[model samples]
Target: MTAAEPNRGLIHFSPRSGWMNDPNGLLHYRGTYHFYFQHAPGSLVWDTMHWGHATSPDLVRWTEQPIALDPAIHPGDLWSGGGVVDLRNTSGLKSGDHDPIVVFSGTQGVRMFYSLDGGFTFTPYDGGRVIAQPSGRESRDPKVVWHEPTGQWAMVVWSDADGNGVDFFVSPDLLQWERTSRYAAGWFFECPDFTPMDLDGETVWVLRDARGSYVVGAFDGRTFTTAWTSPQTITTNPGAAGSDYYAAQSFDNVDRTVTMAWQGGNHGATWTGNASFPVEQELVGTPDGPRVLSRPVDEIRTLRHDTQSWPEATFSAGTHVLGEGCTAELEIAGASRACTLRIRGCFDVPVAPDETLRLLVDRGQLAVFSGLDYRCLNVDLDRRAAGDEIALVTDGPLRVSSLVLHQLRP
Candidate 1:
C-alpha cells in the first residue's frame, strides 16, 4: 500500500506519503522559497534518504514538487544539508547567465549538487565528494553559507562520529573546501547551524544544533570564537525531548532568520514526519551575556480564519470548543498553582499560573510554546479524541487577557 495522506487542517507540513526528516536546503530563489527535506519515499519509516522538494510562495501554504536527489544518483543516502543561490558562477556549474542554486548534502561524506533550472532539479557536481573523510560516523548535516566579508563560503558540519563536536570548513568556489577549525561542545549532535545576527548594535554569530541549545560567538570567515552559550538546550519542545521536532534549520534569502524543524515520525499512519511551524530568531543580551530568542513568525496570523478574541475570561473547570485546527494565543496574568489544557485526546499542557502559552492544535497533534523563552512541545492525540473541544482544568480561578483563537485552514 502507498503512504497515508496527511490530515488536513494541520498547521505544519508533511509529505503526502513516506518518511521525512530535517529541513534541508532551504533557499529563496526566483521569488519563491524552495524547501528541501530528507525523505525516504518507499516507506513510512526512515531507511534510505532522498532530497524531497517543496515550494511556498508564502511561508504558510506549501506545494510539493518532484524529489530532487535519489540514493541511486549519489553513492550514499542523501543526508541533511543546505543550499545557496550562486550569484556569481562560484562553482562554475552555472548553466546560463542566471545564478545557479548550489545544494550541499551527504551521508558518509558531503557531496555537492547544483540546480541550473531554478530549484526543480539538481545534478551532482563533477568534483564528487567534497569532504571525502568525515571525522565521525554521525558526521553529517552540512550547513553552508557565504561569508561575504571574506568573499568565501563557510560550512559548519556536525559529527558525533568522533565525539560531540562540529568541523568547520571554508571554500572559495564552492567546489573545494578546506578544514579551518573544530569545536567540541555540550550535546552538539546533528543539524548544525551558524547564523549571524545583530545584537544590540554589535554583530554576533550563533552556533546551534538540533539540540536547541546555541552558542554565541564571533566568526571571522575562517575561525569561530565562542563568547557564551546557554546552559540548557532550548528544546523545540520544552519537556518532551522525544517529540517529533528535530533537525531544524534557519532560512536564508530573508531579512530576518526564520527556522523550521522536522516534527516526528510514524504516528500510526501510512506517512511519517512533518515540519514545525517556522519561527523568527534573534540574539538578545542578558545579564550572563547574549541569548538566542525565538518566536513564531507573524505571517502565520494571515492563515487565521474564524478568529475569536476574548478580552478576559475565567477557566475554572470547563470544556470549551475553540475550533478545529485552531491556534490559541493566550495570556494568563495573576498566578496561583498549575493549569492543564486538554485538546482532542491530546494537547495536554500543565502550565504555571503566570505563564503565557501559545498552543496550536491540529490533526490530532499539539504544538505548545511558553513565554519568550520558547520551549516548544508537540504531542499526538488519540484518534478517538479528535475534536474541537478543549477542557481547561485549573487548581483555582485563572484570569486570561487578550486570548485569541484563530482557526487554521487546511
Candidate 2:
C-alpha cells in the first residue's frame, strides 16, 4: 500500500474499492457479525447509496462481502438504517433453513426489508410500503430495538418535528409499525440510536445522535423520558478535516454493547472512507447522572505482536521516539500534559492525569480514546507518513501512571 492506491488498514475496516460512509444495519446474524454501510461502488465519491456488506467472526478481523443492497434492484438510494435478526420468526419472513433478518431505511418515511438467505439478499416488505407516514415534518434513519418485557419491537427514527426530535414506533411483527410517541430536543438529528444498557445494576436507555451527543434516559417500550436537562457529548465534534468519527451504531442480536462509526477522513484515488475500530459501550455514573463511555473491543489484542510495557513514566518537554513502524497501539494512563501523536498526523490530544488514553494507529487510520472522549481519523499516504514525525511530545512536564506500546501485525 502506498500513496498511489489507498493504504489498506491493519485494523480499521476499509472498502475494497469505491466510496462508503455511515455504518448501517450492524447485526450479529447466525455465527458472524455483519457490517452494512452506505456505499457507492461506481466512484470514489458519495453518490446514490447502496448497502455494502462485510462479515467477521470476531470484531477484529473482517472480510468484505458482496454488495447487499443495490439501488437498481433495491429501490431508491437505500439510504441508512438499522437491522435485526428475528430469531423468533416474529416477522414470519423466514424460509428454508435460516432465520429472517429485518432491516429498515428511507426518507420522510420508513421502509422495511427482510433477508431470508442470511443477509445475502433482501426483499422489500409489502413491495416497499411506507409503514408509518411522516407527522410533523421529514423522517428518516430508523433504528429498531426489541423490548422483551413489552414483547414488541420499537424503532427510533429521526424526525424534523418540533425543531428536532425522534419518533418512536412500536411493532409486533416488524411488518407493521404504529407511531406511539416522539422525543423532541435540540440535539436529536440524523442517525439516531436508542439502546438499553445496564447502569449501576439498573437498566437504562441511552438516546444518541450522529455527532456522538447523547443523553441517559428511561424507556417503557414506546415512550422515552429523561432528566438530562441537556445532552452530553461522548466524542469530539467532527468539524476538522482530519478528525472524522460520526454516525455510530451498535450491533443487534448481540449480548454485549459494541459499536462502530464511519471515519470520514480517508480520501484516496481508489476508495474514500473506512469504519472506526469497534468499541464496547458502557454506562458509568457521573456527578450529573449516568453517562455513556466507550473503549476499544478487547478482541483487538489479537493483533498485538512485539510488545513492551512500563509501570510508570514521566517526561519533560522534548520529543520521544516510537521506532520505525507506523502501525501500533500506544496505551498511556494518567497523563499530565498535551501529547501530539504522530501517525498520519491524526492523533493530537490533551491529557490531564485524570483519565486513561489509548491510541490505535494503522495504515491510514487513527483512533484515540479515554473515559471522556472517543475519536477516529483516516489519512492517505500522500499527505503524511506515520513515522515521519515524533511519536510523543509535551510542552511542559508530564507524568503517567503506566505506559505500553505494541508492534501490531497486519
| C-alpha-based local distance difference test score of model 1 | 0.72
Query: What global local distance difference test value does model 2 have?
Result: 0.81
Estimated TM-score per prediction?
Answer: 0.88, 0.91
User: Of the candidates shown, which would achieve the greatest lDDT relative to the real structure?
Assistant: 2
**Candidate 1 residue spans exceeding 4 A from truth:** 1-9, 131-138, 160-162, 229-231, 236-242, 313-339, 382-386, 391-397
How good is model 1 by TM-score?
A: 0.88
So what's the TM-score on candidate 2? 0.91
Per-residue accuracy of model 1 over 70-124 as CA lDDT, tens digit each? 8887655588898888887788777775688888877667888888898887777
| Per-residue lDDT of candidate 2, residues 1-410 (tens digit) | 23335456767788778888888999997789999999998888878899999999988888889999887777654888999999999988778899999899888888888899988789888888788765666778899999988999999988888789888999899988898898888867788988889998988899988887888888999799998788887676554222477888999999889999888777667778888889998999878777778888988898898787766788788766655466788888767666655554444555555467888877777678876677666656434563443266777787777878888776
The alpha-carbon deviation from the true structure for residue 23 of candidate 1, after best TM-score superposition, in angstroms, is 1.7
